[model samples]
Every structure is written in structure tokens, then in C-alpha cells.
Target chain A: MEKIKEVVINNSEDVILARQAAREMARETGFGLADQTRITTAVSELSRNIYLYAGTGRVIIRALSKNLKKGMEIVAEDRGPGIPDVEMALQNGYSTNRSLGQGLPGTKRLMDEFEIKSEVGVGTTVTIRKWL
Target chain B: MDKVPILKMGDTLILAIQVELHDKMAIRLQEDILKEIHDTGARGLVIDVSALEVVDSFMGRVLSDTASMAGIMGVETALVGIRPEIAITLQEMGLELKGVHFALNLEKGMELLQNIGEIFYGED
Candidate 1:
């Protein structure tokens, strides 16, 4: 079992940066391109959500290898006005964003594992995992 | 989003689309446009995605499919004015939209439309 390493980034644009970093790490750690793409898409959705909906946040990326397989975990946390209705937010075709409502549900569909925790006026935390 | 009608060469029609191309609305729009293409038998379609900031894979795939569907129905599709940043992101993510045309600006897109004749001309 390999050790878990963590990286944290702040700033809205850093969402893409964090995804790039995670993709590189995932590749070096033995993940395939499909896994890499899925992870990045998931990251893009969450990171964009944090930037657009919440205004600011930090993306914490953790890399781990276990049982001869590589695994990556990403945690995106924001301290802005949280989602008032998480259930509705996760539903397809639902978006507070005027652009496309695909962000949240799209993220859910792309990840190997996904979890979201949020409270109104508090904050939002989304955790995603993928194994390669 | 503003919708505008475009005329070219005194005989062709190009509908200008300006809005977000997401999953929710993309299908209905695609179907409506396909029907319009069949009805008007227009020469081209100009989708202005400049105002759009984000595009997911599913939406990208749908657009690509719509372009092909239009081709079978005797209409050509052109995607004009995508931001450089968005283009880079789409390319990095491997979103290669097939059967569609792209231009840096709408003027250039309209210029490209000049070469593609009316849809009926290509029908036979």
C-alpha cells in the first residue's frame, strides 16, 4: 500500500489547474486516460460549481495506491452560500446557473464514487474518488 | 439570448443562434432546427457559442450528432465564434465535434457559408 499525498489549491481558475495536476499525478501513478478524463470532468464540474455558485473554494487532491492499484480522491470545499436544496440540485435539468444545468448531475455520472454534503448558509463539500 | 435571421447571396438563409448549448435545451433546439431546415430547406446554420462559457461532453456529442443529422436532412451546420480558452479546454478534453464548421468570428463564418450552396442543390 502506497502512502496518501495531498495537494490544496485556492482560486476559481485553479479548478482547471487542480484537474491538470490530478491528471498528471493519476497518469504517473498508473491510471489510464479514460480514468483521467472522467476524473478531470468530475473535477471541472465541481470546481466550476465552487467558482460559479459559491464564488470561492479550495480543491484538495489526494493520491493513493493500494493493493497494486492506483486510486485518486478529490475534495472540493467552499465557504460561500450553500445549496438550499441539495436534492433538487442533484436532479438532472436543475441548475441555479443560467448557462447549463448539467454541472452537478453530470459530475455525479462521471465519477467512480461521489459524495456531497452541504447546508444552507454554511458551505458545500464534494468528495469524489476514482480507481485505476 | 438573442435570435436573429441571416440572409446571404439573396437566396440563402442562416439562422443565428446565441445561447448556452446544454443537455436540457439542446435536444429540443436540435429537433426544432432540424425541422426548420427541412421546412425552409435553408443552406446553413450558424451557432454562435461565444456567449457560452462551458460545454459538457454530452452536449458536445449532441451537437456533433445534430450536425450529422442536418447533413442527412440537406442542411449544413457551422459553429462560429468559440472563445480560444473554451476551444483549448474542449480540445484537451478530447471533444472533437464532427460534421460541423468553426470560425473565429461570425463574419468569417458567413464568408464560409458563401461557398456552400443551397441545401436543395446538394440534395440530388
Candidate 2:
């Protein structure tokens, strides 16, 4: 069965719900254990980033496959001040926020595939993929 | 998230961690804890994680790696109070933490350490 989950995060508290959305979808889709964990970790990192940088956002999880090898796509979007330098943001240990810089780069490293798009004054959207 | 602190009892060092152990804080925390173990020259290192709700692959790997690093520094490390939910997530994530000892709570962890050390200072 195809499943799609969407959750809007307006505060740090919303991050948990966003993560649950991804976790529940992964579990329901019959993905492998590692794939499920990877999805949950990715969601947690991105959701935390949204709260820290944009102060709000939405996490979208969509199951893309149904056969022996299943896959899912996660997209996190926010309407806030976007990153001026995407390259710098991808670098590990480089963070605009005061906390340790591990959110975006770590999230990218955890998933099987990752992509990001951001425009200054527009917003930022991060997409991650994992296959079972 | 509350910051974890280091406790010293005689020659033993106990570090209580009560927050989400993720990438951003892992390096700094590792350096600090290792340095404390080295400087104090403690026989046992106890990590309390009852307050932690989740343990991801990143954090789990770091903990296991730190355990090996502690051995080289002559300190035995023990993990205390890992919640069942955290265990389920770690298993679901296919994360393996090798060589780090664990206990259900801080008190039991201390008892195990005392037995290993052959000190047996009961009733704390």
C-alpha cells in the first residue's frame, strides 16, 4: 500500500510529531529496520534544523516503491530567511546557529540520497531518500 | 537539554548524561569526558542516560567508539539507564554499540562497578 504523511512544525515541540509521521510511515510501509532508522534519524535532524533556523516548517514523507526493494522520499520546507551560502551550510562543523553545526550535514550523511534548495528571502527545502 | 556533569568519588569518575547525544555535541562532549577520565585517572566511568529518549546511529556509534578510546586511556566505561524505547530504536536502526557496559539504573551500575573494582562500598 502507498502511504503519504505530512506534518507542519511551528515550534520545537512540532518536531517530535514530524518525526513520528516519518517513523509511522516507514513502519507501515514494511521497510527494513535500517531503512526505518535512517528515515527517523533524517527526520529528527531536519525537523530540529527547521526549529532552530526557520522557527517553523513542514515535513512531508511519501512512499515511492512497493516491491521487494521499497523507497521513500522526505521533504522539509520552511518559509523563512534562507541560507545565503548553501556550500558553507553543507560543510560539517559549519553552522550559522550558535549551537554545534551537525544538523544539515549529519542529516545528509544519514540518508541514501540527499538534495537541498534554498533562495534568500524565499525559503529552504531539504529532500532525503532511503531504500530498503 | 540539560548539560551533563562529571562526578568524582575517590578514584572513580562518573559522568551523567541527560540529553540527546547527536553529532553537533558529540565531539565536544567526547573530548571533555575523555580528558576528564585521563586527568582524573579514574578506574571506572559511568554514563547515566535515563533522561535520554532516543539514541540514533550517530550517537550510538560515538558511544561505542568512545568506549574503545577509554580502554586505551585505562578507564572502564559503563552505560546506565538506557530506556527500552531507545533500545528498540537502536535495534530498528541496525546500530551496534560494542564494548560499552550497561545497567538498568545508576545504583545498579555503581554496584557492578564496585564489584569489578573489588571495593564493595555498599549502601549509598
Q: What is the DockQ for all candidates, taken in turn? A: 0.08, 0.12
Q: Which residue pairs collide in model 1, if any?
A: none
**Interface RMSD (Å), every candidate:** 8.7, 6.8
B-chain TM-scores per prediction:
0.79, 0.86
TM-scores for chain A, candidates in order? 0.86, 0.90
lDDT of 2 by residue, A1-132 (tens): 567888887765566677778888888878765566567877987877777788888898998874677778999999879999999988766777643355677667668889999999999999999876
Report model 1's TM-score to 2 decimal places: 0.56
**How high is the CA lDDT of each candidate model?**
0.68, 0.75
What would the per-residue lDDT of candidate 2 be over residues B4-122, giving only the tens digit for each residue? 68899876678777655545466678788888987888878888877765565446766887787887887777889887766765554445678787888878887777777675444
DockQ, prediction 2 = 0.12
Output DockQ, candidate 1. 0.08
lDDT by residue (B1-124, candidate 1, tens digit) is: 4233444433344554555433345667777777767777676777667765455555576678878998787667778877665565566444568899888877777767656753336623
* Fnat of model 2, as a fraction: 0.04
Candidate 2 chain A worst ten-residue window by lDDT: A97-106
Lowest lDDT 10-mer window, candidate 2 chain B? Answer: B87-96
Q: Per model, how much of the real contact set is kept?
A: 0.02, 0.04
